[model samples]
Each structure stands twice: as structure tokens, then as C-alpha cells.
Target: MGMTLVRSLFLIIHQKMSTSSSAILTPVGVRGMNVLDRAKFLRNIKIPVLKVADEKLSKITPICKQYFLKLENFKPVQSVSGEKLKCIHMNPEKIGAWTDLSEIDRKSLKEHSVNEDNFIMKDIELSYENWSYGTIFKAVLPENEDIVSGFTQVGHIIHLNLKDHLLQYRPLIGQVLVNKIKSCRTVVNKSSTIDNTYRNFNMEVIAGEENFLVTVKENLCNFTFDFSKVYWNSRLGQEHERILNFLKPGDVLFDVFCGVGPFAIPAVKKKCKVYANDLNPDSFKWLNHNAKTNKLNMALFKSYNLDGKDFILTVFKEYITNYCLGKEKLEKGAKIHVTMNLPAIAVEFLKCYKGLIEDEELLEKFDCEIIVYVYCFAAGTDVLAVAKSMVIDNIGCDISDNIIDIFDVRNVSPKKEMIRVGFKLGKEVIFSAKDCVSEPPKKKLCVDN
Candidate 1:
């Protein structure tokens, strides 16, 4: 039986009595267990032998609970700075609406109408201000000459104007509509950088060629980020402060696809022990640079290509062996948090590690957390299947029930597509689930052995 073999191996190999060996009979999960005859024996075993689903099964039911919880906490908070979104104004006559004409005039126009109906959808050039007039019968401009275009499609609410020109020609109708627009609301926080009326969470963004200095006016928490020569995109800034709320003290954070230390620097700033890495040399340079800039202790950065299985195995062995050979034995094992920003590629490394590594005794050596960003391309050709293939090649054949939590699927583009799934490792020892894009799509359906 698989359980019998695992127990025997653990008893024979495990000698050191550190934090991992507190007592006897710790529940363990055996993934990809092919011994069907021994499955019953393994199940009946006193220890908790958790069974993980294969890649094929996981795809069929990809809605892992851990993936959802992380997203619930990661979404951007409402705009804190009371900065209003931009709007525009347009002339009333150019808007094209029909009104103010008498019944006689209307009858005359109806006689000459193309549809031979007394009523017509006309663009009478109404101003934005006219929208506030309840009794006023007005005609709005159609979309691209399409008469069916509704009021919402005609133009933005800001484009309305007043038609009267006898006096100073002020837009009375437009002014009314402008008042209807709600004033911008700001989320209050000390770390905000905004000043005076805009004093909510204002960040002074100092963009550089390879790095940027972000200083918060309120909290005085300044962070210099290295972007591997790539400026951090505006979207990241939008979500940074919000995501930073989840960091806790003393947590070991690992940013696997760490690009210029966006997650790592903030994590270290929160006093978390960080192990950040990136395949790109430029990225690692910035990662280390940012780590030094923040003066984060216990933060380690490694540069390696995560696409290959052998490279991953070597890295894990080195980190584990190094930890084991350290001055003190791992107290309760290293509390590691492996962050994978690359969704399409992280799974491969996870699968490889799951297949190659199985050290129940060394469970105290490391703990991992994975962040997977699943980006769906077009929707036409069975995107789920493609996603399934991608998931299998990336995450490996089987996974453990050690799912901490997963974030909600985020839309990366206009189309309701592309999602990011973050996986936190739970109570069991397992490799990272986040994956990279190394294995191309193949016709073969992944088989779980």
C-alpha cells in the first residue's frame, strides 16, 4: 500500500527531531496515488491521507474556494481622492433636437415627411441644459443616423447646452444638468497623498527611466520601485494601495514572477520576510535595488528561469538544503509565500515539483503560496479547453487540498475575459499552482495516471 510505503520511508529517513517532529501521527495527503489496490488501505490508514484531483478533474471543476477569497480582498477600494472625472460641453444647436414649433408648423413639416407620419424622430440641436426640462418635448440626435438610438446613446450628459441666445447666452439647461452630477467622493486614509480638498490618499508619482519614487503625503511612507526599465503601469498604481492592505507582519512573502518588486517591496515594507525572484535579469536587478532601497531585512532575491522543471527542482533543493544546513534547524519550517504573477506559466513548475518532490519529513523545511493570473484570449474557439490544456501543462497532473484561498476572476480588458487566480497553500505541503507559458497548446488530452 502507498500509505505503508510512505510511513516506512518517513520512519527510516526522518531522523532529526526539530519543530516538524513535535509528536507522532500527523495527517498527510498523497497526490497522484496510482496504487488503486492500496487506495483503500491508504484511505483506512489512521493518518489523514488527503487526495488531490488530477489536472483533468480540476479543470472540470476549477472553482477552488481559495481562489475566490483572495480576490475578494484584492479588489481596488473606491477612489479616495475627490478628483472628479473629466466631462465636456457642446453647443445646443449642434445637438439636433426638435421642439418649440407650433402645431401648424408641425403639420406643414409632417406633410413633407418621408414616412408620411405626423411625428418624426428629429435632431433639433438641443443643448445639454434641456435635459432638465420635464414638460419640454425635445428630439435628441440619433446614433450614426439611426433613428432607433435611445436617449442614453445620443451623447454624454455633459454635452447638453442652452438654446436661448437673447441675453448673455449662459447655458441655463447645461448648468442644471451639471448640478445633477454627483461630486467625487474620496476614501480617507493617512497613507493618502492628496492635499487640501484632494487630501485623501494622494501619491506623488516621480517617474524615472528605470525606477519611480512614490511618496505618500499623509503617512510619509515612501517607496522606490524598480520596473526592470519598464515604468509601472497606471493600473498598478490604481490597485497598489488597495492590495497592500492584506500584508501582515512576519509573513514570509515570495514573489516568483516578481517584476521590479511591485508586490515584494510593499510586502517587505510591511515587515514581511520576502523571497522575490524573476526570470528577467533587468527585473531582478530592480527587485534587488528596491529591496535595498527599502532596507528590508530577511528579504532575498533570486534570478532564475522558472520555465524549466530541473531549474525549479534545483532551486527548491538549494533553498531547502541551505535552510536545513543553517545555524538553527527550521523551527516550525520556513513560512514561505510563493507569489506567481504569471498565470499561464506557473502551473508547469507546480506540476513538476509535485511529481518530483515528496518529502513528508522535510515538510517543516518550507511552505509555499502561489498566485496565478489566468488570461483568456478570444472566446470563440472553446477557450475553456484551451484553458484546461494550459492549466494541466502548467500546474501538473494532480494537486493537494491545501488550497488556502483563490481570488475572483478579474477582467484584464474590455471583453469580459481574462482572469487572475491566486492560490494560497493551506495546511498541507504542496508545490506552487501558479504557472508560466512554456508548453504550447497540443491536441493530446491530458491523462491522469
Candidate 2:
């Protein structure tokens, strides 16, 4: 029998029980009654089952027992002739069960006659078992499996990049994610791509609270930032830790585009002096807040809000001059490291390093080498070669193959990749005016903006 027809019959029986006063509810497979006899008895007798509201079930249990009706367990079934048989019990009533009726009962019920009004037809509410987000969404929207796979959770926020076709169902998908995911309290959809220098994408809240403040723990450090304003990629936890493992206690780190101090603050906690800066004022504000929250000494860390080029030329240059030159030369175990993480344009910022220390005498006297870790996006199969060439062109010097170390970070797209090119800045690249001078390239590489 079709499930729709069976459910319709179950509702009919439920309605009759609710309205009728004398309802003799009986199970289909009684001990003494055979399949044919049970079918005959059900067809001939007008058995009215009592339907008590779910909340009032406790009060009506005694009344169900007084009538000697089967009030223990109710299992709705189909007759041998493909007719749906309704069963009712008083202990705890459930409308339907998925079971097949015997062939004899199906035929007998078809031959027997019963009032149509006794079988009340109402809407059937299907119950669902709590399952995973993908499973539940698949059950509800089997056609849009990709939508379920596109969501990313950052802290307590569920971030989704829904396709244009799935925009109509954004609310439905977002609500389901919020309901299904225990850690998520708010859900937002990516409304626009990251096109600005701040590296922040436009987002619209589709479900739950409107708040975007979140606290994320990484590398044993707690970081709090406004998700809507600043840029934070929880996916980069491994990258953050990988870089941290390379640092020593006395290393000086200059983060050119330090969004909320993800790299800087952690370095500070490791007893490294950090000079962190960002173009976004919001990022700068939170960077200071996070530094203080982490209980880092103000003397060990300095935060700045300035353009990438200006920051390198000003704040970073000052650090090199003061701590890396003259009387305040770095100790034996100390080192200088610059982090340019704006993968899209960070390679171009390498130009600032040229003519960074203009004085030949000071450049020659500078015994410590400045290592730069420039993150950039490279296309094609030979990602390391592309990244190396880009770094060499921007720095205006031929970096030796032995010193340049390029690490493949991650694939940003099918044909594009994010790679980190690390090399030490020598006197020729920093002090020699001829080697430092170079014009911008005619064509630019494709990278995230």
C-alpha cells in the first residue's frame, strides 16, 4: 500500500477516537483471533478508539484500562488486502508504524465494510531523528548537497559561501546550520568577495544573533577579534604554529600586515620583540586589545596603524637602526625577521626593503642578516619558481638559489596557489643604490585582493 493512503487511514482512526465515547481499540494480531477472524471482527464492529491529548495522557490511562481495551502498545499496520489498520493504546499513543499487514487480513479487510467517517484523514507530521548537518540537510534538500559542504565554522560563527542559485534558500540553510551545529551561535553568508586592502569580505547574518565578536584560541594563546571588521582565518592555525616553531626567544619580528596580531602577539609571548602594523584601524585597535589580553609587556611589543610601505620605511626602519645598528647591536643569539603576509601584494612590498638601510657604512657594519618571509600567490604548476622570480623582481636583486627557500602554503584555486618565499636580505640588496633601484613590472601576477 502507498504510504500516503496508509497515513490517511491512520489519521481517520485517530479523529474517530477523539470524538467517540465508546471506542473498543484492539490490536490486529490478537492471541486467539486468526487473521481472517480479526479482519471480520474489525469490519463488522464499529470500534471507536479514545484519543486523549498528548499532555493529558496520564489522566486518561485509568479510563483506558476500565474498558479492557489494548492500551499498552499501539502499532498501526496494513491489512492483507492492502488496507491500513489503525491501532490505539492509552500508555503512550503514536499515530503510525512502518509494518506490513498479512495477505489474508488485507483481503478480508477489503471485503469487509466500515464507515468512511470512522477513518479520519488529517495531515501527518513526520518525525525526524537528530542526525548530522549533512545528513539532515540531505534528507530535507537532497538536490543541494554542495551547499551543505560549503559552510565553514570560525569560532562560534558559521560562515557560508552560498552560490547564487542557493541564495533563495540561504535562510533555510543558515538556520539549519545554526540548529544542527552545537558550537555555532550565529550564521553569516559571504555577500561579497575580498577586494579591499584590509582583506575583509562583506557578510550578511542569515540566522541567530547579529553579534560578530569571537574569541579564538590558537598556539596556546587567546585572540579576540570582531569577525565583521578584521580578517582572521582559523584555517591558518597550522601555518601560525609552523612559523612559531621557527622563532627563537630573541628574534625581532616585523609584521607588515599584522591583522589583529595573530603572528605578532604569539611571537611576543615567546619573548620576541615584535613590531606589528596594519592599514585597517579596526585591526590595529584589536591588535592592541589582544596583546593586552594576552598579558604581553608593552615594552616587548609595539603596534602601528600605517600603510604597508610606510610601515616598513618608518617603524621597521627605526627598529633596525636602533636595535640592529651602532651601540645597540643585536646580541649573539638575537635575529631580525620581517613577515609580509598580505599574499596578494606582499611580494610587491619587498621594494621597500631596497634602500632600507641607505648608509653604506651602517649597512656594512650591520653584522646581522634580516630574513624576510614573503607570502604570495603563484599560478601554474611551477609555484616555487614563480614565487622566487616575483620576490627577486620586487627586491631588485638576484637572490641565490641556495638561500631562497620557497614553501607551498596552500592552493587558493585550481590554477593558483599561496606560497611563502623566505630569503635573507644582504648588503647588496639593502645598501647598494644601483641594485636597489628598479621599476615596477609591466604585468602583475593574479592574487587575492
Candidate 3:
């Protein structure tokens, strides 16, 4: 029988699977299978597809398997439900194509005439067609304007701003002006070269001050933290908010890369102690300023450059692993949780702890979960190629292969593709201890011949 048939039969018999051991590769035939087709097949079946009838399949099924089902309903609590908006990219100049007056779509288009002047299309000719589009132009809100009404009529966002060209984008234009106004208010507002480019405005660019701002609140039970300084406000700031929203009262947080104390201060305000660590000398200066400015009980700020390898191993050993033959320390209390936002560079760091994890007794320590937000770049190649290569290279690691499909991938830079890989590690040292382990699957994966 085919592997898919065998696996399907196995699942029908077994309800649960051990997620740690066993060959878990999805058979090639099943890999490209469409969910809709599977659903259709499932509907016609009398027995639930999950109800299998084979003994051997049951033995191996649980070795490396877990399943999750989601039911969504519109409610206040469901606000965070990941509902995606569908879009189509239509060229304004090509509106006549298939847009006959008799067509209902053409009538809708006539009723809602979008302003082409407001739309931005570079050298490309503006044409209208049923092309996929994903993004809406929300109006730029000035500080005093009500943010809800700030958005103007719906206009399809055709293109995103390049890093260098962001100054032209309305949102970034406002942000840049605001930043410029703030910098001009500083005492030393004068032209100076910062990182090769000369700045026209003057500000005390202390360790962290340039990257962070200090603001105090009145009658506030707890300090409020803001991450307005980050260069990429929309993407990174959204991520920062997601992490902060998870905080609770008295929950100690350690932001290893506590750049402007975004995570640290918020945790502290919630009556939780925080340990903020960052190697950037500039970051600490602002971190201290913001803590004192907000009148928050300043938490510890460790300013040493944590060698990435050392930091990862330290986490794996102290916070993660426990039960090692010579070492047995529970990562309880405040130390139980740690935050590391640097996923792009974390793979390199995982190398150091390869040996310590091999000891099973110590493996249980790592049972504590990690919320890693990995960022990857395709480096101008196809995204599938990059993703497949990453999976094959990081072999033996107990990552949820299916979990990778849950990311919100976007083309941040033309030549760079971004993907976030988040997973919970098992209590087993899956890393190979052999030094100079040859790289796995370095070449691009070309699925289509």
C-alpha cells in the first residue's frame, strides 16, 4: 500500500500520537494534496477519516503526531481571530477589459469609482483586471485626529514603500516629520554625520536615547510602554504589541534584546520584575532614561554583549535544561520565562548547546516552551526553495513542520522574503554533537521541474 494510504489507515485507528519520535515525513503524494479535496473526500465517508483500523499504523502514528481543530465565530473575544482580507490588483488603465456594462462587476466598479490619482503605479501601465490584491490604504492620522475616522475611502494599496522611498509614503512622511520635529527640540540640534549620512537635526544621541524616547504618565496605576522609535514601525511594532499583550500581573519578563525597553518597562508596570539585557551601549542609556522618566521601579539592565552562542546555550542550560547528571536546577519563578526576539541569528547560537542536550536527564529542563519569532530571507531566490532548504538543514530538531504554514509571509524587501518560524522544543536533545557537522540541503529545493 502507498504511504498515504498506510498513514491514513494509521490515523483512523489511533487517536493520539507521540510527537517526539518516529518517521514523520509527509509522503510526497500527500504533501501536494489540497485541503479542499481532502475535505470533499471526508464528507462522503461514513466513518470519520480519523477512525483508522490498523495495529502497526497505531504504533507508529503516535510516535510523531498531533492534530488541532479550529472553530471560528464572530464575537468580541474572536476579534483576534486571524481573518485575512482578500484582494485583487486591477490596473486602472485596463478597466475596459471584460468590464462590459452588462457585467455585474462592471456595474459595481462604476458605482464605486476609485480615484486613480490617489493610486501609485510606477513605470507599470495601469490596467484593470481581476488580479489578486491584499492591502488597503488607511488614511494617515495626525496626533489629534480620531484614529477610527482617519481612514479615507477604500483604495486598494498597490505597492508598499521601499525603505529608501518610504519618505514619500504618507504614513512614513508624517512619522518622519514628527521625528524631525522632536529632534529639532533637542539642545544640540545641528548637522552631524551619523553612520555615514549627515543629519541636519541635533539631538543628544546617547546610547539608547536616539532609538528610544522617555515619556511619563500622570495618575497612571502602572507605567505605559511605547515602541515608537523603531525604524520599521508597522511590522516590528505590531510584533512588539503581540508580545506585550500576553503579559499579566506579577509575571517577570526577561527581554534579552530589550532594545528600548519595550517589553521590560511594560512588564515592570504590571507589578512584574523585569531583567532587560542588551549589548548596545546606546540602548542601555535610553533604557535607564525611560525607566527613570516614567518613574518605574528600574529593573536590572545587563549591558554585556552576550555572545549569541553563549546566550543560547545559557538559556538551554539554565532556563531550559535541568536533570543533567552534574547539574539539576529548576527554572521556576521569574526565570521560568525568557524572551529572545532574534530568530534570524538564533540558529547559529543553537550550535553550542548540542552536547548538553544529548543527556536525557537534562532534556526535561527544556520542556519549558519558547515563543520564537523567526525571520528568514530567501535572498532573491524562490520562497519555497528557501523554506525547504531551511527545513532540511535543521534536521533532527523537533519542529512542527505544519506549524510553518501558519506564518504571515510578506515581501518586505524586493530581494528578501520574510517568514516567521515558531515552535515548541521537546525534552530531547535532538542536536548532533559531532563538531563540523556537514551542512544539510544547502542547495535550493526545486519541486517543479
Please provide TM-scores, in order, for all candidate models, with all chains considered together: 0.40, 0.69, 0.41
Candidates 1 and 3 compared: the better one by TM-score is 3
Off by over 4 Å in 3: 1-235, 247-254, 270-275, 295-304, 321-339, 343-346, 356-360, 364-367, 379-398, 401-406, 409-411, 430-449
Q: Write the per-residue lDDT of candidate 2 for residues 178-279, one digit (tens) a residue.
A: 765567789998743575556776889988899899988878788888999888776567787778878899888888889998799999999888889888
Q: What RMSD, rounded to one decimal, does every model reach? A: 29.4, 15.9, 23.6
> What digit string (tens of lDDT, one per residue) describes model 1 on residues 54-98?
322233122112212111112211121444311111122221122
Superior by lDDT: candidate 2 or candidate 3: 2
lDDT assessment of candidate 1:
0.34
Q: In lDDT terms, how accurate is model 3? A: 0.34
lDDT of 2: 0.63
In candidate 1, what residue range of length 10 has the lowest lDDT sum?
147-156
| Residue-wise C-alpha lDDT for candidate 3, range 1-449, written one tens digit per residue | 11232233223122221222121111112211212122211111011012112323333233112221111111101111243311122222232223212254334333344222212222221111111010011112121221121111001101111222222233332222233222221111212111211101122321112332323222232222222222111234445555566655654455655655666666677666565655444555566666776677654333333433454556435534443443534335422344554434433333343454555554543444434434454554557556545643553354555233324455544455555554433343343454564432222121100
Total clashing pairs for each candidate: 44, 10, 19
User: Residue 8 in candidate 2 has what lDDT?
Assistant: 31
lDDT, residue 207, candidate 3: 15
Q: Order candidates by lDDT, high to low.
A: 2, 3, 1
